[model samples]
Target: MTEQRVAIVTGAAQGIGAAIARELAADGHKVVVADLNLEGASAVAQEIDGVAKLLDISDEAAVARVVGEVVDEFGRIDILVNNAGLVPFTPWEKLDFAEWKRVFDVNVNGLYLMTKSAGDVMAQGGYGRIVNIASNTFVAGTPNCAHYVATKGAYIGFTRALAGEIGKHGITINAVAPGIIASEGVLSGPHADGFDYVVPMQAFARRGVPSDIGPAVAFLASEKASWITGQTLVVDGGHTRN
Candidate 1:
């Protein structure tokens, strides 16, 4: 039997976030779908008897408020999936500084702010699980994504450092770095071409779907992973084996 838990999953409007929300709900946790796209978030929440909150994770005030509301509604926040990220992959010569800033703003900074705010709440309650979504691109150092790689690398660093700092607080911080997930973003983002050659696995051969990443997240967010922290669970179907 699974104990009741309340999970807040950002970027839950679609793709991996939606899959994780459904998996968690199936595991018996009340879910709150938080995303910048309010309509999409609400729709997903409605499907699973979850709640939706409009959020721009990049904004500190918005992140704090959303976390507060979840804590207030659920009384305790047991899991947080920091799955929102911006990936703008272009050559360095053509990349815009503002675009790079936006990528970092959401991927690294937003993640830090959410973890900080949620960590405080979970610390007060004495237990919590945080799963941050990074990417295998950082490990392989794939070319043409200087901005994306930097932010995700920062996320990996944040996972390690925060795990050490908050381990004593009874909270665990970990990360999952997926490669070539067949999501809307992956199919349409700047990485579509790159995924074909750089991924080392054909999209039609054995590329990952959102479902492939969901259970790993659920496990990490569950008590089963209590002993694991400061780790990066790579879910790239054996890609980046070098």
Candidate 2:
């Protein structure tokens, strides 16, 4: 029998995060749906038969508390999915410093905090998988969202550097870069128009969905991918092949 693992997925209240949570649960991992929205997180957790944790990943105290709580309950964390992030579609000139900082706060800083806290627990266990959610925009240099793209670029850089530092401890960190997925936030946000623009550019005829990202993340979090680390698997329907 395959041993069940425990996974903590941040920003898992809805959209891609929710999808990742569901996938991990289906893979037989005890999932914790951690999000800023307690209600949404609770609902998803209930549906998936997992735990719901209210978390502001950008907050140091919140990150620490959640990590400690999960470790206390589950005994160990096998996977940490840094899928919590904010995407704002603003022109470069209109993007303010505060907005840029907010993007980094959640996307970059929060990722670091979770990885650091979870990496400690994984080190003790001598096994862990860390999958970061990056974006294809960083490679394509997608316009009107400089702040969002920059954070993803940082994630890729961090993943590579951190992989080198943590590999000796039996923890592997990698990234999955999605290309213009049609999630709830993206569908309702100003960037919705870009969906049409993306379809024509993609090699795949259909639009990218949240589910398309799940398997890649789950694979990275699985034992099957033990040999892979410090790489960014782009699940963008071949939109911007690197």
Candidate whose TM-score is highest: 2
Residue-level lDDT of model 2, residues 148-211, one tens digit each, is 8989999999999999999998999999999998899999988889878889999988888999
- How far residue 135's Cα lies from its native spot in candidate 2, in Å, is 0.3
Name model 2 segments beyond 4 Å from true.
none
Clashes of each: 0, 0
- Residue 138, model 2: lDDT of 88
Q: Could you tell me which 10 consecutive residues in candidate 2 have the lowest summed lDDT?
A: 1-10
Task: Tell me the lDDT of candidate 1.
Answer: 0.87
Give, for candidate 1, the lowest lDDT window spanning 10 residues.
Answer: 198-207
After superposition, the stretches of candidate 1 with alpha carbons farther than 4 Å from their true spots are 198-204
TM-score result, candidate 1: 0.95
lDDT tens digits by residue: candidate 1, 127-198: 999999998988788888899998888888999988988888899999999887877777787777765675
